[model samples]
Target: MTTITQTAPLGDRTVRRIGFGAMQLAGPGVFGPPEDPDAARAVLRRAVELGVDHIDTAQVYGPDVVNELIAEALHPYPDGLVLATKVGGARDERGEWVRASRPEQLRATVEQDLRTLRTERIGLVNLRRQVGGPEPDAVPLAEQLGALTDMRDEGKLGLIGLSTVSAGIVEAALEITPIAEVQNAYGIANRTDEPVVDLCREHGIAYVPYYPLGSAFTGGPRALAADPAIASVAAGHGVSASQIALAWLLAHYDRMLLIPGTSSVAHLEENLAVDGIGLDDEDMAALDRVAHLGAPSF
Candidate 1:
């Protein structure tokens, strides 16, 4: 595959913006080792070969599996590649997401990420807040981001970011440190984080949407895949509905960095190829109407 020309500023480096998310490389429910480890490694290697530079993964992914696969596939890590991970949660034996964002937990998680990824310092580390759902371990902003900033000073984290946050939290985190990016659940179908996206755009910070495919939205991925508006736009562009969803995001905002995850290399190429599918004014208008079609606002 040819290199995508579109780029976005991530920290001090500029990346292709259409990056890979390694969450799907893990096993069922994002826990344990994947059934096919060699397949996962191949996918990771293939992604870098296809010009994917920004890879989003977490230590909790497989509780450690995906990071190792990434290290095995691309440990020497090509130049201009940025590996971003999150801290704030871990998985129990049963594979439940357990919030663990205390200062101590943050420190340990950061350390573990460095060890697993075989990097002395991570390119970017996101302080994932336990918001948007009921959780027992919600720490104050100062405690969470403060630990990360300390690590940054110690040269363990290159850039700081926030995940699963609101606009107010983004503003607040700015006061704590220079936030390079914000990863939130945003897509054409879920506008709950619209305000945050606008805030990031206004400040020139990267807005990396995790579920850019709208898989976890109100009506699930089928709702978006089966939508007439998206399908019509896809037909005009001769791309799939999913490509329309990703391209719409790319067209909607200049700073939007997509991290759509997939285990299959074929699917990875398809997701990364969205930059070629352009959306015009009429296509964008039709897609904008999709938000009104039972799309949830949070």
Candidate 2:
């Protein structure tokens, strides 16, 4: 099968713009192995078959569950597919998420990811900063970025990225090191990262928006699925609402990359089909109106 033309340059590496996020491959509670191992394997394999050349995962995602599945499912990984993973987070004994950005912990996590992914070096290692509380008092952002910078120099990492970060953090990171990509939570219902997306565009860096289908909003997935505006637009194009959401993102920014995660092969194929769903002027305006109906602060 011919590969899709969805790749964008991240420093020296080229990765598919519409990539796959492996978070959903984990089990219930998203803290352990998947319930259906064979099904998860089929999903990953189908993603590759559908022209997905970029796969995003994190050690915190299962704390190792998703990456291990990735290795098991795609050992001897195909050439030209970029496998991006993140560090700086772990899980507690009870499978709760924990932030650990200490230099040693960061180093150890990278080493663990390398081993789990069965690769000498990670194609992209996003330094996922902690959110949802008071600022961290551990190592400074510069120091953490410096550690990754050193790793990149040592050929242990091909590129570096930042996840769930702000413009100020991006500025600080750029001062100490080069950032190849930035991952943030953005979608039709969530505009908290719009400024961050603009910054990436201005700097020519890839802006990957996680939860591109409107996660964490008050209406939830069901609300998004039933949005009258989205449904109307989707009907006009004979595409799914999910595809309209993704296509709008692809048209919203040239530097934008999408990593919608799924555990079903059918859903994976449907998500990839977004690449071929084009938006017209009227549809774009309709989407924009609904996207800003209850937009959040950036």
Candidate 3:
């Protein structure tokens, strides 16, 4: 059977491997406030109650909407809770993601997060790069790290992280500062970021897959939870396909910390129940084959 430890060291703190992502707490398009603010708050509280110590969010998510919700839901955050937010971007009037990786821009963004999050300091801040990847001409990766480093030095941020970046970018950033974690679009079927994952393991950095359940945003493919292989495995285990997908991630990487997001208390509880659902060698083998199972593997 493939078993995984429940907690992993994140900087000085150890958080449950299955954490919470605050992106979905916002409204559609990740813009504006959620339709049901009370319901969203309930999900956040329930996650913590279920022992989710790592919460990932960003200032750009809902253009400060999610951060505000987090504060409203879980202010005076419980001890051991790690609040991770992303920088280097923002939402425009049309709710589109735009790069703001300049050093000054990053500094301003971190300061803004402190205000909205209602905290003296943020636990983690990932420098979310541009869609097409890093452009040296726009703003060198070093400059972005420098901006974050300065804040880290001043005690405004606990540990620096990176998102949507290449292994080369991680290498470059390492020379400037120690990365506590890396968040990217990775899942059982979407194994394109394998190289980055290998690099993270080499350096002891925690790997957090943003869409562990897969996403429709990535070229509008079917959800990974709907994959035939995953569904079959779920049936054998008598659990949701979502649980099988998340369990595979934990079993696959010891350092992986999942931040699967949801806005409902029921789904939140279902996600938290992923712990102790053992996946045997046969199940692991079938899931391991998901990445190469033809088109729309999800």
Candidate 4:
């Protein structure tokens, strides 16, 4: 009878491991309002009704559009609901991500999230580093984390996290502040961050994988769709390849948390149903070899 609705400590709060990622709620290219605002609101409400309490977002997502929809749909968030947001990135007029981690900009984005989400204080604020784009900016790590620390001292944030960073950055940030979570791109096919995940697990930090299904670089679910082992496992479990993909992540490590983003109600339900697909030792063994299953070239 166990379900994926299990709760774990995220700093001072406990939230379900399988939380909702609101990035896709934004429009194409993660800019402008969603094509269907009502549908976005319904997904937020439905996630809560399905026992999801952790919701991850960033101010750059729709440049504030998703936050507005979140507030409109589930403001005065239910107790135990952890609202985790990010700063250090902004979208230009063309809907491209730009580095904006200057101290003033970080402060402005944090305050903007407060206003957009209509919350007095944010539960968790992650300082998303900007070093993954085609032309990554040389963001100063000390200055960025310092700004968030000052805000946390002033009670604007409950906990702090880092995104799209390496183990070195994690160690450096730890010296300046306590990181409650680390968001990065990781999955069965993409084991590049395995060391980082191990480091977080050792320190009991939550390793929230942003693109469990794959990111724009990793082929976005296509990475798994073409894998016969995953499909075979899914067939044996009576689940879809996507569910097996998620379950593989959950079974890979205890500290691993999933934030699969989707705009459809049916897809959201399917992603959440990962809790029902229990991977036995054989299944885990098969999935454990996925990293060597001619892992995608991306």
Candidate 5:
């Protein structure tokens, strides 16, 4: 039902829908450097070579570790590449995630990203909120959003995005400033953010689903492709379960941009090749059934 084609609008440009997420580029637990620094840089290079022009990253990732790697790997970035990052959180000495959404904290994080990513202005900066108890941090979202708006007015960011927030929150945000994109925890195995996804589509905002193949890669749940239905479809196509999951997402929504991240070149190639897989009505139906099968969460 979406008119979007091979590429989708994100921040200031229309980039290939199949983009890369840089979380896994960090060390395990996303707390430090990767095992192979050169390999990590090579993955970034390979991703660009594979035509992935949009990359999603966050300062909280590796607590400044990932951004440094990204800068090291892709500084003097090529033309048309969009660098999207997230704020609103930070990491502790123990590597635990904690809210940093206080207005000043948010501002500080943006400054940090600006320096770490080696860019004057980021393409899109998402305010990642903890919709549930553990993190939202006692500050009114409007106040937090205001800080970002101040930066935008100063030309520090190209556009504002939201993540891990509810549809109601998004509606409230629209009353303040236009949101360019949204990164939510959603996939074939978990469609909990359908309302937010549809809302973004209705408003022409890009919705980027984080766990497209399930948290299998990120250590959350059994892989979405492990579902018998998805596995069967992948088997039939002589492709991977991961490919089946990504293809269904592309077919199901018009503006859903994918950021399937991987540390290995082979996996990166597999994730990029998803567009070539064709899914029929039967295949789509089978994949849709997995959403209600008690999928796990982050």
Candidate 6:
């Protein structure tokens, strides 16, 4: 197997490029606890075994589900593994996601994430802002980032990030703190965050794309699997369509970090194997031409 060597500096910490997303470890409804606790643990263990050094999770995934699993499965974690978790969202009684970016809530979530991940300080914490929500305007970006900065000083966080943010929000964040990474949805099928990805690249910030594969709104499974161009490329390489999709993203950006989530070990292995799939210039050009077919809206 060809070992893909992609690295980026997170303020000062160096992390591997291909990361693991822990959201799928939760139950059917992401708001509730995981259906199979053992499966969650096994997935995490398998991630480390596969050489994934970066693990992404959020306090709202089960509002606590996935982080607890990480602690249980990999406490006393291997050296050089970066455990990143996010805050700023919570679940309501009906299992609906609610945005909570207030300073107090931010602080509370950080504390809980640290405790659940069994770490003195999280390697990274993404402050996920709700898109088209009323709250973003209410809380000044400075105040929100300042809270994270204070926590960093207190040794609760190593690096800070922003999710679902625009270029303007990213600029505002840099004024307060050194934005280490930016997580947004950017893939072959969804290019809404293209400008955001470009901005991160220019600023030397890692662009960690959440849904490098199509998300629920982006015509989900059938759309991705049945993509004619992707199928052709996969056939040429003797790999799965999902592998073709991920490889395209990895080759698209220099600082791109992938966090493809899956509950199945078979699927996880397929996703990781993307690093081994090579796409030359001709292959990339061909894929690029067909990439916009049925592209998802923001």
Candidate 2 lDDT by residue in tens digits, 187-217:
8867767889889888899888887776532
- For model 6 the TM-score comes to 0.93
Cα lDDT, model 2, residue 274: 83
Per-residue lDDT value at 290 in model 5:
70
For each candidate, what TM-score against the reference? 0.93, 0.92, 0.94, 0.93, 0.94, 0.93
Clashing pairs in 2: none
- As a TM-score, model 3 comes out at 0.94
Best candidate (score: lDDT): 1
- Winner of 1 and 4 under TM-score: 1
Candidate 5 error regions (>4 Å) = 1-4, 131-137, 216-222, 291-298
- How well is each residue in 126-203 modelled by candidate 3, as lDDT tens digits? 998864334542688888898898999999999989988889889988898889999888887778888999999999
- Candidate 6 residue lDDT tens string, 33-105: 7778998899899989988899999887887888998999999999988888877777887877777788988
Which 10 residues in a row give candidate 6 its minimum summed lDDT? 289-298
Lowest summed lDDT over 10 consecutive residues: which window, candidate 4? Answer: 289-298
Instruction: Report per-prediction Cα RMSD to one decimal.
Output: 3.0, 3.4, 2.7, 2.7, 2.2, 2.5
lDDT of 1 by residue, 238-260 (tens): 88888888887888778788898
**Ten contiguous residues with the weakest lDDT in model 3:** 289-298
Instruction: For each candidate in the order shown, give its overall lDDT on alpha carbons.
Output: 0.85, 0.80, 0.84, 0.84, 0.84, 0.81
Model 3 bad stretches (over 4 Å): 132-137, 216-222, 291-298
Give residue 292's lDDT in candidate 4 (0 to 100). 36
